[model samples]
Target: MSAPIPVKVHYHKQARELELIYENGERHRLSVEYLRVFSPSAEVRGHGPDSATLQVGKKHVGLANITPAGRYALKLHFDDGHDSGLYSWDYLWWLIEHREANWADYLDRLEAAGASREPLGIEIKQL
Candidate 1:
């Protein structure tokens, strides 16, 4: 089975989400923080599962840029200075398929580590 191809990709800065429209007429939206924490980059994934780093205080992280990495992957640049992940088409499909479970597991891990998704210091809000 091959990965589903995305016909369109849009970044909604206000919403902080990446929207993907697939050839099969399916659409999915993923948050920037979610993508960051689940990045395929070695910095996030590490050498293996046991070495994987937990990305904390990323609730307010934003997507700085998105560039195509050849024809099969995307290079996502985060505002927090992370730009090493290469999100392949196959991997992206898997992420969309397992988003809920993965997010839940991440939250559990954060709780266990006594960490938080909230950024440190005052997060000023605009009215």
Candidate 2:
């Protein structure tokens, strides 16, 4: 792909929503939760080809901070205490550009694996 330029970054910091406007006139609105679950970290990616942490219960997660990595990437810290991924500008751009398709695929994979985005709510009663 060609070089990607972020023409505009509209961040509703309090709401944890980021909208990136690309130089080519494409706009992408992404939720913080989506970004967190897809983080490119060893904690999430695991080792080599036989291990990967199945990230769950991140539907309510949000970005705690967004730090620049040198001049070409973003290091995102999630409110859930995960902060070990350096997201390249190109990676972020790709995520934004293919948000819908990727997210749909994510959901499909979750379903195929008998997993869910929502955790079970437990109720305790005094008996």
Give the range where candidate 1 is weakest over 10 consecutive residues by summed lDDT. Answer: 118-127
Candidate 1 lDDT tens digits, 1-88: 9698799999999999999998878999999999999999999999998999999999988888899999999999988889997999
lDDT of 2 by residue, 1-127 (tens): 6448676767666677777788789877788878877788888778754576667667766666777778777788777779998878788877876888979877887888888776457522222
Clashing pairs in 2: none
Model 2 scores a C-alpha lDDT of 0.75
Residue 102's C-alpha lDDT in candidate 1? Answer: 100
Output the lDDT of residue 28, model 1. Answer: 96
TM-score to native of every candidate shown: 0.94, 0.77
lDDT of 1 at 76: 96
- Model number with the top lDDT: 1
Best by TM-score, which number? 1
